[model samples]
Target: METPTRTPTAPPAFADVLVVGAGPAGSACAQLLARQGLRTVLVDQHDFPREKVCGDGLIPDSHAAFRRLGVYDEVAASAQPVQHVRCVGARGGHVDVPGTMSVLPRRQLDHILVRAAQQAGAELHTPLRFEAPLVEGERVVGARLQGPEGQPPVEVRASWVVLATGAVPQALTAAGLCDRRTPTGTAVRAYVRHAELAREITQLQVIWHGRLRGGYGWVFPGPDGVFNIGTGVIGSHSLEGGKGRRRGRNLREMFEDFCEVYPPAARLMREGEVLGPLKGAPLRCSLRGVSGEHWGRPGLLVAGDAAGTTYAFSGEGIGKAMESGMLAAEALLHARTQTPAQADAQVLQAYAAALRQLQPQFVLYERAGIVNDWPWLADLLIWRARKSPRILRRMAGVLDETQNPARLFTLSGVTKLLFE
Candidate 1:
């Protein structure tokens, strides 16, 4: 047999910053950096308008970021606006908590973000996969990238690098930035189209049941008659040092069970036409990949899902991903006014500190994940929330970020629910 051959690499290209992965995080980071006149280069393995396995739930947190990125109006134009979330418990208890929400397929959403980055003057490269990092002693000075088959690899030299690759990131491993390769959580979803079913489900539905002790299911309304339906569970990867090794005992079974148990899901399956095969994607929840100050190697910083920006309980990551990316951009902008050595030390340190500041919120969500194990609490919360407008308002607060989740997921909150 003929020996396999390695692709030859082209001459090195230089930039002020090299961003791998042009998802929301990478695109947001690149846009901010490029807007500030940093010669930013954004590369991705796939082209634009690509599908990203997601529920496409845009909450208030996401809206804030979209506004700051100057793409709020455009996103709003294409998204299906929602007014509330209907939480259904195992006992069939349901409560509709009013809040601002929207649904847009990730394929279109991510394309909008990439366009914003391009309009901001960031150079975009596609079919370009990150092969490895260029190391100089302790610092990562650049990276090795390869395009599609027959295309020569490209060497990219940059003053700094940002890793925004999503969950299941090989780039993290290549750059010596990965902590655990296993996914912290996993989800399966599909699009269903039925005129009647689509019209019936006007809001988001989050279902919890006894069989789904370690997970939850959701049905969100996308643009037109398409409805996004799915289930998710915390997977084998946990920060608990293997104590939380429940990375979905059986995801397919769980999904099938969800469809059977939840009436809405059953109706969708029976009455609606599924647009495509049920797709599954891995999730890096609870920021399991990075902790403390080890956010990145020298001269490099990690952002978005690669750095574990996805939350555990609610499974909302888009806003946090964009926030982390913007924070990385902020750190770089601030460091530009300092000495070379000081800038290097301060940039990574600053980015790490900023990420830590977000840790408390993420920690609360992680703690709240206990609801997946004890779904009775979900029943009680819905029961109480329906009767007590106070509890309902608090739920709204959680969505608006005006109130902490502790009000609903904590022991004290549970006790209050009983009394209230």
Candidate 2:
């Protein structure tokens, strides 16, 4: 179904920048560019307040982007505070971490970012389908969009085009930045409402149980008497089954099984009424995807999932997505200073450099995905953390990014955890 649109408006003949998606990355990029006095047009296939498949959990990483966009207070006021995180191991061993996190449904979150972009002087267009980029030789001038219904195809031009089309690989693939079939994982979430469930819980739980040895399932308490329950698994692992059978579990089957077996999850979902259908989406992570040269082509740049900035292990993309957008904006601003022939390469090089600096943790997570495949190691880590308060605190700090992940791998660090 087409997302409902706001008041109808005509497309401009030209703009300084054309953003081809109104999600966090697109909205943040548009807002930042507009604030810098660039004429920006943001378009999306779905309208505001639309449902997006996600865990709805916002960790410390999302704080900077919200504040930068001037919507931190608004989001904070409406969020359900998550004071602690609990990870349940394979053998039921566990670690509980105390920290600050919250849940704000993407409906409210995306709306906030879109409105913020509008307020920042960017023209917002929704219910518009991005068909292709408007290309002249090697430079991207703007985009070609499909108008509502049979109205007509519309061509809008801009000096630079930004693709924030999210996890759908079509746009990126069409741009030749990614292979037609990029590796992807699946995630499914459903919302449930129950007063007792909300009243008794204010924490997030990630459980590694049963068939979910490699991936995990989560239960996140949402604001206003709701819960976001879900499971995510890499595509490669999703097909594991019983005995010698080759059949695999689907996302729906995984969700049902997860809720049926996990104690805390079962308890929360017991009497709660399901508020929405189980929705699923593909996650394009940093596992094996495109790079800077692929992302930054002449007069074009990609951000968010289209650029595969999501963390490899956790699949956390909101913070990284927004960061990429802001980085793109900064690069474009710098590009304005260079000659026409040098602008594309300059922005590309600058954005690549910035991403390298910002994503060392994610790089480690990519390598750590191998360990995640080994349930015994995961169980050991959780079991050890459950026995040591100091290690638990360290893990908590690592989650908040206050402590470096590299330190956790050091000889001294492992010794302290083992003996202290």
Candidate 3:
């Protein structure tokens, strides 16, 4: 089926900055740039209030971004506040940890931010497919886009281009700005409306169960009795072995088995209605050589998933994407007076340096065993936490991003596990 289309009043010339993708990264960058008096245009393939597959969990850091964009109140109004997180381990062991978190469907969240950006003077276009970048010499000047149906192609020329395209990184790859790498695995997710199930498991919970190597299941609760239940597995592991000798098992089958084991989840499956078809996509942790030299080529800059900012372990991308988009806009504003070459090399360099300083903390956590390396550690910790509440609390602090890794390792209870 052809994509839907919407047309706005056409401008005589191009915008100062053109952002491709209307996700958190694109909207955040467009709003900040427009707020600073730069003429910005934000375009997306799908319209606002459209659904996107995600875990629907938001970290504490996400609150800060919402506040900066002046949409915190709107988001809070639409989302469910989650003060506690319950983590279930293999063998039915569970640990209930308390912290500040929230969940909201992306349909509501994306619409809020895109609207905020438009209110801030950004020109918005929806259902626009980005065909390719307009290259002038080695520099990317703008992008070529086609609307739904036989509408003529429109070329948007901009002094600077910000790519907030998600995990696909299509813009970057198409422009020859960076090489695209395959993700380690795919995440499959589906939404369900389960009011009765919500009453039973009111707390936001992430259940890691089953024997699917390199994969785990999660049940994240959202507002208005909605929940997202999903599973993910490393592509390599899924290819290892299975009955019927199929190439690999799909996520739906794995999720079916998971629900069978959990009573609360089983009840939801029996009564809850699926919101839509199950969706899946590849997940990438980090990209090699993500600095400005790799990402900033002439008039273009990549941010968010396009820049490989997703955390390897938890698959968290929103907060980091917002941060990267803001930094890119800041760099563009700083380079407003310089020549294009100077702007690309110097101003963009500063943005890369800033990102490098901030990225280590994120990268370290991804490498930490909690997310990726050790399945046993999570199970063992959850099992132990059933007996020792102090240990569970400390670990919760780490997962909540309230405490540093150094402090986390120094905890006596955690240190005991390390030495033992």
Relative to the true structure, how large is the alpha-carbon lDDT of every model?
A: 0.85, 0.78, 0.73
Give the per-residue lDDT digits (tens) of candidate 2, residues 257-314: 7877787677766778889688988788762356434466888888888877677667
lDDT of 1 by residue, 1-420 (tens): 212212123323998899988898999999999999999988888877688999899999999999999999999999999999999999998999899889998988898998889889888888688899999998999999988898877899999999888997698889887878888888889899878877789999999999887889999988888899998886444544657643345777887899989988988888898898989988887666764365887778888888888888878899999998999999999998888689888998888889888888888877778788788889988888888899999999888878778769766678777975
Per-residue CA lDDT of candidate 3, range 128-239, in tens? 7788899988888899987778788889999988888777756666767656455545688888899877777767666665454456677888887888888776432222
Model 2, position 363, has a per-residue lDDT of: 68
Clashing pairs in 3: none
Task: Give the local distance difference test score of model 1.
Answer: 0.85
- The residue-level lDDT of candidate 1 at 13 comes to 93
On a 0 to 1 TM-score scale, where does candidate 1 land against the true structure? 0.94
Using all chains and alpha carbons, the TM-scores for the candidates as numbered come to 0.94, 0.91, 0.89
Kindly give the stretch of ten consecutive residues in candidate 3 with the minimal lDDT sum. 405-414
The stretch of ten residues in a row with the least summed lDDT in candidate 1 is 1-10
For each candidate, C-alpha RMSD in Å? 4.9, 3.7, 4.3
In candidate 3, stretches whose alpha carbon ends up further than 4 angstroms from where it belongs are: 1-12, 234-249, 287-294, 369-374, 387-390, 404-420
Sort all candidates by lDDT, best to worst.
1, 2, 3
